[model samples]
Target chain A: MNLYEYEAKRIFEAGGIPVPPAVRITKPEELAKVHFGYPLTLKCQVMSGGRGKAGGIKFAKDLEEGKALAKDLLQLVIKGSKTESLLVEPMVSIAKELYLAVTLDRERGCPIFIASAEGGIEIESSHNVLTEPIPFPYHPYVGRNLAAKLGLKGAVMAKVADLANKLYKVFESKDLDLAEINPLVITKGDDVLALDGKIIINDDSIGRQPAFKGWMEAHLVDMSPRERRAKMTDLNLVELDGNIGILCNGAGLTMATMDMVKAFGGQPGNFLDAGGGSDQKKTLAALELVNENPAVDVILLNILGGITACDEVAGALVEFMKKYPERQMVVRLRGNNQDVAEKMLAASGLKLYPDLEEAVKEAVSRSKNATKKPALAAKA
Target chain B: MILVDKHTKVVVQGATGKMGAAHTKRMLDYGTNIVAGVTPGKGGEKIHNVPVFDTVMEAVKTTGATCSVIFVPPYLALDAGYEALDAGISLLVLITEGIPPQDTAKLAAAVKAKGAKLIGPNCPGIITPGQSLIGILPGSIFKSGPVGMVSKSGTLTYEIALALTESGYGQSTCVGTGGDPIKGLDYQEVLSMFEHDPATEVIVMIGEIGGNAEEEAAAFIKKNVKKPVIGYIAGQTAPPGKRMGHAGAIISGGKGTAESKLEAFKANGVRVAMTPGEVAKQVAEAIKQPAKA
Candidate 1:
């Protein structure tokens, strides 16, 4: 779960990390009453990196330019990340820049703190760090020792150590995979401020972390009735940008299916998992999600059933197609009750393939034909 | 004989519960000598003709069950593991999830200190072919064969086993190490055992995205093991830094990505399959390939 920059900053602020005062404005009108001083930096907060390089940041000489940049950013979308709001802050002219971040080092099976004297573009230069891997799941003494090497001392050093310890606690406690601060700038007065923050919480630990639970509860957004039905069934349904909508069970299989589509020279628009088990209603809901995607030219059903019976899924697919006749369907069945499901699918005049390799090939070929059929027939 | 021998009677913690009851019936159905179950406040209750006790020690003493399978919740899973460890159980299999990372580190330490072999915390327990059906995988998918199977995903274990069985390959033992980020037995640990097992001709590994377990396993496979091992990593196109529903399916930084794992395996000259169905064929071919002169 990747939090937007502002949300991550809020978490950092709560942990006593200093950040320049900032506000998120969705519209130019919202910046009308803004009282922040000159030399303001307007940044469009998108999830992807390279924001500065992507022209997502602007330095406005005056309030009018700042407001105009904010409005322009609000109207633009960069790399599919919406610029719904701009993070406005008083720009700090830095004397020196240091970059530091804390993330789970999966290879060592522990958290890691990556730090370098270089900051900004140097930090983003791909290979900034020149230190050996530090053992995380750290000892408190270890934290203090690392802090000392950073020239941190006195109450301030202690404070940074305390912050590191607390950050470790939050990383472990909240099941966060990442807690980063890029270009942790040093002001002319030698104050450390986290200029940008990023965090990716462990989704598995969402069950254990109350903070994430509370965030979800507080920010539960509205959805359409169809989406509401899909949500009620514990299935996450999102439309994709391509015409091939996939319905797969396991995460690995979903990716494998998506790759197979790409391997067969087809584009996959979305990834949807119906989980391990699905009754008829959940299957129907999943199909509805696929049909709702306008970019979807054909829906692919790929499932390796263990606890879930393929027969039941096939039955659901047949039933769903009866009501939603506008979309084409391709079903691939394997595992339990696969034979019966294939028989049913065959009888329904729907395309069914046993092998994933062959199935993806046919699905890709068919979708192309479907796309070109109207054009060719209109010419005739 | 695998990690746990046939003579080792087993007790299941959280017995008479949903998962415990289901596994108890299945294990007993498979002729495993499950002697006791532990469920707090449900002592004296019997699940699948196995006696239930409130404490692990009581079950161990009364039923002589030296092995325990745990199906406790996240908060109590660590305690359940500790309880089994304290009871002097030589082998413990945990199938619970959502345990705090710190708690898992502590539990792993304790298990090591007790010299007890732990299987999983979020895994689908372990199984000995034709001996015991101790885990949650459906029994119909497995048959006694010479191949040893170990995996991180529960669903993929069944899929791989089914493929092997269909290909006239039977598993000597199959284990799902679970997908929890902090788990007990990893791929390398399981691979080491498979290398020593005489009955095991080939080891089939199914790994998923997330941590560097696959990369570490590949290194171990390259350096130490002489046996032919074929593997298929799940989440080929998984986005970096995104968790793939499974607790352990997180691609942190640049590590744990399929591309990195693939590169490691390729660099090591390990035979890798593009799909789960390809695992059996590759393993069969690798087993027949003569060692480099």
Candidate 2:
């Protein structure tokens, strides 16, 4: 899960990395207690990057200025993400701005450190960057080696090297995909500070990290209720803007189905993977998630069951059809127990498509047809 | 030659569970010699008439089984994999999903260090058609032929294999390399084996949007492979930065894009198929012609 800057800063501070002291303000009125005061940088807390260019940052010289900045930033939106709060910090003078990050290099199947003498948004394209692969347990000399490559020496060099060592410890311990301190600033006095922080915890490792589990709970508070329910149900769901709801068994098949829906000129309302071996209850939950979306006129369920039995899913479809008779379903069930599934669907006065293309095209046309009819209220 | 034939002895981990027992029966029906089962605290029991043991070392000692397919829950996957590896099971097929990447990283390194190979920590197992069936793939979709297949996906493996079968082009061996970020065997490693194996004539690579696996494979084929390679990439429609069901399918930092992978394949002289059906047709056509340099 991606962490907002303020959240990431908390992790950085706890890890012994130096960051500018900051206070979090959810509203303009909350700024009264922030006594560090004057000429503070008010950074809107949004998940997406390029927050500065997107007008999510402002400066304030006094209490009234800070309050006004907070109010404006709390109402601002960066990219597609709205501001949840503001991080208020006393602006600092910088002698030099550098960048560094410890992230998993998927190709190498290990973690790597990326550092640059020049920091900021353009650091990604900077030729001055140095990358070094880190072995497990993080050998200490690797940090010193990276700092040496950055062309630094003396006390400042030692500090940068020490910071790199500590940063990687957090990366490994937190099970993070990335722990980045972009624009890590060097003061005139040679003190280093992480001006911006970005961290992404590995979602699959949430069970092992107690602190992140709490973060995930707070993370869900901003999501739509349907999305929250999907999370609790173990359904891999993404809300897409469209009219046709698509459900499939495996990750690859689900994506392939979504591509097919788009190929046939039908927009998919959502992408939901029921996963392999989904039984009756999970199948019914998946169907209800899509069927309840009032914008979704048709749900196209494509199950190429290998572990998931075709007949079991067909039974769920029959039960769901009984409850929501008005909803349209385009079903293509195949693989294990397909013959029994075919017969089961036929007995319920429903039909199954034999081919993927035919089923997708039929759903697209049915969705187009349904747009002419009034959208019924989702069953309360 | 195919990796495993009828005589290769196999043991099922977590064999007393519902999935392990069901697939064990399916594999047994396909004539795979599943000699023993392993489930902690379930020793002395039998699944599908196969004897069960509590520890992997005990099972290996008794049956001399060199291969193990795991079905343990996600949290216990690391322990299960290590147990099998320590017990001298050289080939490990991890069938559980949702294994934390950290555990997988540790497992991947351990497997490498031991000079053994792990197929997946979150993937469907491998299969050689009509000879031996392992993991959750439907054996009916495959038939023995000159084509060797490797894919990052499970169902896409079945979908394309079915298409190949329907078109009268069967497979010599098909391996679902697993969609996770780090797999035991990648496209390049599998391609080398297929290139050397006499049974495989044409190669089909199924890749998705994420990672440099496809690009790396294409580079390998351009240099080392003499066999005709046909590539099919999924997720042309997937939005960037959004996590698809597969964790590895996310595109970030201007990397792992479908267009970039497709371009790499084309630049390296690998044949690209836009859709699943096209993959089968291209493979059939490639086989009719002689092998390319």
Candidate 3:
């Protein structure tokens, strides 16, 4: 989960790190009230890297210019993610830009800090420094010594070390995947300030990070009905802007179904797993979860039986369709007790194919025909 | 009868529980000599005629079971694996999930140091058809034949096995290495095993999006594999950077994309199958073709 710049700055403030006074502006009325003087940097709130190179950021010299810049950035789309809000802050006159980030070093099985003297650009110049693996329980003495060795001294080195220590704490406690205070600026007055911030929290850590979770909940927008239902059921669901809605057991099958869908020339709307236990109610819930979405042109049920019996899933399908007669579904059921499930499906007037290729092709054809006919009378 | 011989003694950790008992029954039914069982508090108990010990060392001491199958919970999955490695167990199969990533790194390191191999923490375990069934995969789908199968997804093994059997090709051994993001045995490890196995003339490798495990396996195959290898990567259509099933099945910043995997396999001269049925058919055909030098 990527935190907005303002959110990341709030975390920095909590850690006692110095950041320029910033305001997250959304509405036009809030934009008018910006009391910051000329020479301000307005950055669009986005999750991707290379936002600076993109036109999503602008610098303005006056209030009128700032408002116009904010309006332009607010409407901009950076890396397919729209800029719904903007982070406004006064520009700092920097002597040099330094890069500092703490992320999980997968190879070392621990947290690591990557500090570089060259920053503010995507690609640092030749002779840019990237530190060796610095383990956690981050010692401020070690940080200060390293900075001094890198030619930074006096209060500048001490302040940078202090910030590094605090950042490490946040990185560990928050289970952040990536935390970057790019351009930890050395101002002319020798004060350190974070000019740009990026914080990517671990997805699994959402359970522990209540503040981040609350912020995400507050910023809820563009959630599909299937997403809402899956959220209610505590299922992981992502509605891709596609045609086929896939419901399968296990992640492997979910992935295979998505691939098979595409191989057959169909796009997958979302990936839905019924998990290990595929009971009647659970299967019905999964079907209803996908069926509730108007965007889903067809629902594909791919289940490979083991502990999850095929007959139980087949029974659930009958019950669900009987309750909702207008639903269209294609099922590819195999593995344990699959024979009985096939028999059941045949009785229900739905042809069951043992081959996934045939099943996917049929679903795609049905979805294509259903999409082509705009009028199931268009009347009512 | 396959992958393992009759002399390969097996141990089951957490054997007093339901899953352990079930797998024990299936393994026994498949003709494996179930040598010992281990449960922390349920020592001295006999489940399915196998003596249950309080520790893995005790089980190895009493029964000489060289391999261990672990059915412990997620929290203890890594520790259970480490226990097997420390006890000098050559092969360990873990069927648990939610094991911390750090723990996996530790287990992988421990296993490497001890010259031991671990199968899975959230995997379905390995099976040598007609010899032993250590995991939760159903026994009915398998038969003794030439195709050696390895997959990240547990149930996909069943799907591919069924497809092969229906196409008149039986498997020599099938292993589901699990679909967890941080896993033990990857496609490269299993492919090496299949490459040397006398019974395995052809290989079917199934992978999902995420990591370079599949691509890594392809490079290994190109350099070392003696048998023909056919590949099918799941989640070809999965949204980039969005985890499909396994936590690791994500395409991030140009890596682990399905097209990249497909291209890698093609470059390695491995037949790429777009679906499970095609995968089985391709493996059968490759086995019959003369190996290209």
Candidate 4:
């Protein structure tokens, strides 16, 4: 789960890292009571990057300006995500900016610290970035090593190293997948402040972190309706703008099925992984999710039942088709009681294909035909 | 050579859980030599006639079990794994998913230190067809033969295995390397074992989007593996940065793309298949060809 700037800054403060004092405003009227000082930065809270480029951040020199900007930002939708709240903080005067972060290096299977002399918008293109792998329970001296690598010295250097160590401590203790302080600013007085912060908690570690469990509940409030419904059903559903709805078992096979649908000239409306060993209830939930989508013209069920028995899947499809007799479905069930599943489907006036290619081709053709019939009738 | 067979004595960790009990029955049904089971409080109870012990050490001491299949939940997987390692179990097949990456990294390091083999933390485990089963893969779809298989997926592996079985090619051993960023064994490591195994003449490698494991395996196959190798990659249509269900199945920083992996395989003299059926066809064709000089 990605944390808002305000939340991440709160964590940073708890970890003894210096951050600019900030207040969160959920309503525009709340901005009137804000007394952080003049020259405040109003940052729109959304779970996306490039908020500044998208006009989600505005600089207000006074209270009146801050209120107006907060109102505008609250109403703004950036990158398909609505701005739910704003982080109001006193803008800092920076003598210099640097970047620092800690994230898992998946290839090496370890945590690594990334640092760069250049920070802010152009950090991605900066050539001065350096990375150092940190062992578990990392040594405090490694922070100074990274600080020195970024060309820091004196009291400011010590402060930056101390901040780095604290950030790492927070990252490990919180089970965060990533903890980043972009544009760690050095004020004119040589005091370093984390200007902006971002942290992503590892989803698998959510069970162990109660605070993050609460954060996940808040995170779900921002999801699309379909996504929320899928979450309730424990289904992995990603909504897309297309016509054919795909239902399959396993992540890899689900993706492969979507590719096959696209290859066969059909647009996939959603990606749904029914997961392994899904019973009739989960299968029905999956079907209901796809059926709820108005854009879905045809539902395709592609399951290679290894741990999942085909007969159980067949039973669920039978139940769903019996209730929604008008909905079109194309299924290819294989492995583990496939013969029984095939027999069950055959008796129900539904056709089951043995090959995935055949099932995909049939579903694509059926969807094309279903769309054309209405258009032709309207023309006639 | 793949670390499991009929003679390999087995013990089950977290044997009282739903997954452990279910797959234990299936493994035993397939004639696996399951000698004992271990559940913390359910000691002395028998699951499917296999004696239960409180700890892995006790189970190993009693049954002389060489391998352990872990079915503990994610939070406890590392501890369970450590117990198995401490008991001197030679091979550990972790069937549990959702283990934290940090825990897995620590577990991998410990496994290396103990000179033990760890199959998966989110994987389907290893299966030597018609001999022994250490994971939850459906046994009906596989048959013992000259083909050796390794995959990063559960159902996709079954799909390819079914395709191979239907195409008259059976498997010597099939290993699911688990779909996590960090896992016990990579494709290269599993491929190395298959390369030297006298039973495995043809190798079928299944990979998905994410990680450079396939590229590394392709390099290994190019230089060291003389067996006919056929490969298939899933998630060709997966959008970048999307999790795609699996925790490790995301394309990050313009790397670990299915197209890139396929291109790497083609460059390394490994036949790449676009789909599961195509994989079986390529493997069959590879089998018909004479040995490379």
What docking grade applies to model 3?
A: acceptable
* Model 2 per-residue lDDT at A250: 83
**Candidate closer to the true structure by lDDT (higher is better), 2 or 3:** 2
Which 10-residue window of candidate 4 chain B scores lowest in summed lDDT?
B284-293
| lDDT, residue A209, candidate 3 | 59
Please compute DockQ, using alpha carbons, for every candidate against the native two-chain complex. Answer: 0.39, 0.67, 0.39, 0.66
lDDT of each: 0.73, 0.86, 0.77, 0.87
Over B1-293, each residue of candidate 2 has an lDDT whose tens digit, in order, gives 45677777899999988888899999999888899999999999999899999999999999999899999888899999999999999889899998877678888888899998888766777888888887888988889998999888888788888889988998988888787886687888889999999999999999988888888988889999988999888887887766778889888787888899999889987888877768887997798874662
Q: Proportion of native contacts found in each model?
A: 0.34, 0.56, 0.51, 0.60
By lDDT rank, best first, the candidates go 4, 2, 3, 1
> How good is the docking of model 4, by CAPRI class?
medium
Q: Which candidate leads the pack in lDDT?
A: 4
Q: Show pairs that collide, candidate 1.
A: A243-A296, A243-A297, B123-B178, B145-B170, B210-B250
DockQ class, candidate 2: medium
The residue-by-residue lDDT of candidate 4 on A266-376, one tens digit each, is 888888998888988899889988988888889999998878889899999988887777788998888878888888888789888888889999999988887522211
Please say which candidate is ahead in lDDT: 1 or 3. 3
After superposing candidate 2, which stretches have Cα over 4 Å from the reference?
A220-228, A376-380, B291-293
The number of residue pairs in model 2 that clash at the backbone is: 0
By TM-score, how accurate is candidate 4?
0.94
Worst 10 residues of 2 chain A by lDDT: A371-380
TM-score of each: 0.83, 0.94, 0.81, 0.94
